[model samples]
Target: MQVKTDFNEKQIQILLIAEKLFAENGFEGTSIRTIAKEADINIAMVSYYFGSKEKLLEALIVYRTSDLKIQMENLSVENLDPIEKIDKLIELYINRIRCNKGIYRILHFEFSSEEMEEKMKILNDVRDRNLKSIETIIHEGQAKGIFRKDVNIPLISPTIMGTFFHFSMNKAYFKKLLKLDTDEAFENYIQTTFKTHIQQTIKALLIYES
Candidate 1:
């Protein structure tokens, strides 16, 4: 089943609460009752909205990631050059992950569990769609003779995502090492220093050397 696009106020509220709880306590640890209580709704309401915890988790993934498709579609049609499109893609990815770290963490957890193959299918499908979008950008650059011909297009996403994931996973250590005093300071570093670094790295990969 696809993720529902239109969520009412209450459904969105429940989804947000479920996302937070799943990220904090995990699917096994977070019960329907806990979600209901956290959302200040009854368990029946939770059941009515999502039949089970698994369904809720699936819905959460859909709710969180469904917008990426639309965003990517919009970016593809923009009047920007391929390089500028790539830069915008980086910015979009970074901002999206920064805002929804919790849901991503849950996705990571679900990905590693064999019992969650159905959920994994949903996540993998979304990933493939996103990768195709990224590939389109790279192909556009290649067609224009801007990007190198021998580029390993598949590795590009991991390079961008892996670097950010590594930093975020160890953000506390990095923050202390960088002498950042507050969350705002660290985030500023990410949006500026880290983002530019990703853009530079990708440009280096895609650009041909004379």
Candidate 2:
């Protein structure tokens, strides 16, 4: 599927409702009628726009990731230093997790389902491209002698992805433990502490002395 230029109001509304429903209920558990009622649209409209429940889910994934190619291009922008590029990436990952919060859950849900294999292919390709973008930053740093030559991209990449995912996915536990009951308090923690931590960890790994 093509990366959309942008979605119109109705398309966005349906996708958002689907995202929330899929987050609360598993994909198979949610129904088109439920989405239509919640979204206040006709069932035929949903089918007309997305063709099937599977395509609607695919569209949801695409809507979220439509800017990936642009982000991929950002990795090569000469205006940003290698470290700045890494910061951009860290910011991207953390903020996306922070804002949507449901994206990774839906992604993981697909991974654990046999019915989701075809859908997984599209996401997997996007992931491989993003990984290559990170490797390009490392290569740039190494070229400039700023980053260590022995640094491992594959293993270290997980440090960024895993930590960001873990914190967001487990935020309810964190909120209870930290006693951040309000939305403002929890978001402040993510926008401030959680973001800084990812940036610091990635930088430390990049510049670690051999």
Candidate 3:
């Protein structure tokens, strides 16, 4: 996605290589030289673009979520009701997870707690913006008398996110346990059954009670 603007072709190439490397080798394990060599660019070029390996990893996270921000922005202006927007938001995550499972895998598994705070420091702006975007939608629903004011976005956001995340992070075990026959069947389950479950849970959590 959005990944900020004005990135040149070479910068984009290095970022893509860094994403694949970071996903394969964990953040601490990946090196600047490794990315430079893999991308067939000079070490100085990598530094010129991203400064440090840590910064490059931060860029990767930004690159992945750029389009997501765009999608959310688009949805904000649509004529859909707040409830419909919530469903659309849920669909956006599920669909993105289905299509780019590895990106999600990289995001979920690559961060160790010690450096998570540091790395998130780099990503905090994007993270906070996305959270506030969701929170704004919730407040709109509350004003419309559709969503419960008691619902907490911080808890509810992670709940919705974690449901998909936990499942994806352990999808192999989940598929085997559920006796799914093939990858296609497993994907179908996620897109339909799991997606529906997530939608229902969010709806239940936010629905105004009498």
Instruction: Please identify which of the two predictions, 1 or 2, would achieve the higher lDDT against the true structure.
Output: 1
lDDT of each: 0.86, 0.80, 0.79
Across 42-130, the per-residue lDDT of candidate 2 in tens digits comes to 99999988888887877788788767657766756658888888888888777776677676678765567665776556666667777
Q: Candidate 1's error at 196, in angstroms? A: 0.3
For residue 23, model 3's alpha carbon misses the true position, in angstroms, by 1.3
Looking at candidate 2, the ten consecutive residues that score lowest on lDDT are 113-122
lDDT, candidate 2, at 199: 91
Q: lDDT per residue, candidate 3, 16-86, as tens digits?
A: 88777877887778889899899998899888887777777777777777888889878766788998998
* Candidate 3 global TM-score: 0.88
- Compare candidates 2 and 3 on lDDT and give the better one: 2
TM-score of each: 0.92, 0.85, 0.88
Candidate 3: C-alpha RMSD after superposition: 2.7
Which residue segments of model 3 deviate by more than 4 Å? 1-4, 110-115
lDDT (Cα, 0-100) at 21 in candidate 2:
92
Clashes of 1: 0
